[model samples]
Target: MTIQSDRARDALLDAAEELFARNGIDAVSNRRIVEHAGAANHSAIAYHFGGREGLLRALVERHHDEMARRRRELTEQLGETPNIHELVTTRLRPLIELLDSLPKPSWRAQFMSQISAVPSAVEVAKEVIGDADLPDDLRFINGAVDGIPEGVLRGRAYLLGSMVVGVCADQEAKMNEDANKGSWEQVGRFLIDAAAGMLGAPVTDPDGAVRYPSVPLL
Candidate 1:
């Protein structure tokens, strides 16, 4: 792509992210995105990204490489057998650091949080990031946690994703109002500690007999 084309593509991504975060993925229209991007062509989204889904995939993939690299560095620093806290930190700190590195009032976190509830968008992200199945890090964490039933661990994993997205969204929103609401590092520590506790919490039913109504949980 030419320099002008790259700029237009980035503009579209930025406009889509902010609009999706502010309104919603379903509420935002292609025309609005094009207008927000200041593109002359109404079909700029289609021309650049194929469609909304493709645009969503592009947005998710934008920062994936940096986030993956950060995670890899953190993982390498861990000892042979890291504890739950260390594992949780390794899993989450990279994302928090990424957000921290962004300019104030960034929509990336809020955009991701909104996308997390959309099954199709989540699938797109999973496709790009390759975490649809049991990732090796998650499997390692599961093994490290003693006596936790597989079902419960899976459930906790779902909750962990929800919690991280929700909290990060809230934090990002607050940064818009007061940039000093709290440091990203502080938020990262809190999330890491909370995740460790939640994941390491004892399960009362080891047999996995506890049943609850299956609703769309996360």
Candidate 2:
């Protein structure tokens, strides 16, 4: 595609993100995105992105890139054995950033909700999250608690990974709620505290499994 075409595709993706997030992904149409994007041709989504799912994938890819960059930056700030706060915040900040940076939080939540409920999207979402660009973040996390056995560490990381996904989805979960309760920073700090207190260390239980006590955070 030409540079102009790339620019137009980006515009369509931006519009689709807004619409799909505000309305359900099922509710938004390709024509709507094209119109919202101000492209003269409504077929622009097809011409540029192939289709709706393609556009969604592109937006997700873009968001994932930003997520990875932030993760790398956070990893750099964290030393060999980051404390609970660093570990938790490093994991939580990027999702918060993704949600907070979007122009249409409500719509984004709707889109996320649809994806969460959609089985097809769920698998892909898991893959997108698991194949996350920064393996070093996991390495650092595993290293931070190097005192635990390898078997124990694997289980703990899996559990912690589950909690992190819940935390990342929090923004969408709370989309209808009032934001007057706190700033984005306050929310991030809360997740950091709770996650740090709960999942950043090894479990002492017989089965060696731990449950994060907090509810979901976006």
Q: In terms of lDDT, which candidate is strongest? A: 1
Q: What is the lDDT of residue 37 in candidate 2?
A: 91
Pairs clashing within candidate 1 = none
| Per-residue lDDT of model 1, residues 18-133, tens digit only | 99999888889999999998999998988999988889889888888887788789989999888989988888998998999988668988998888657787677777777543
Total backbone collisions for each predicted model? 0, 6
lDDT of 2: 0.62
Clashing pairs in 2: 21-107, 21-108, 22-107, 170-217, 170-218, 171-218
Give all TM-scores, in the order shown.
Answer: 0.90, 0.69
Best by TM-score: 1
TM-score of 1: 0.90
Per-residue lDDT for 156 in model 1? 77
**Model 2, range 1-218, lDDT digits (tens) per residue?**
79997888878877887776566676777888888999999778878877766676676555666766787798788776677578768767897777677663444544555565445555555555553433444465656654654445445555555555555455555654554545556767776777666545655653555433211212
Clashes of 1: 0
**Candidate 1 segments whose C-alpha is farther than 4 A from its true place:** 132-134, 207-218
Question: lDDT of candidate 1 vs native?
Answer: 0.81
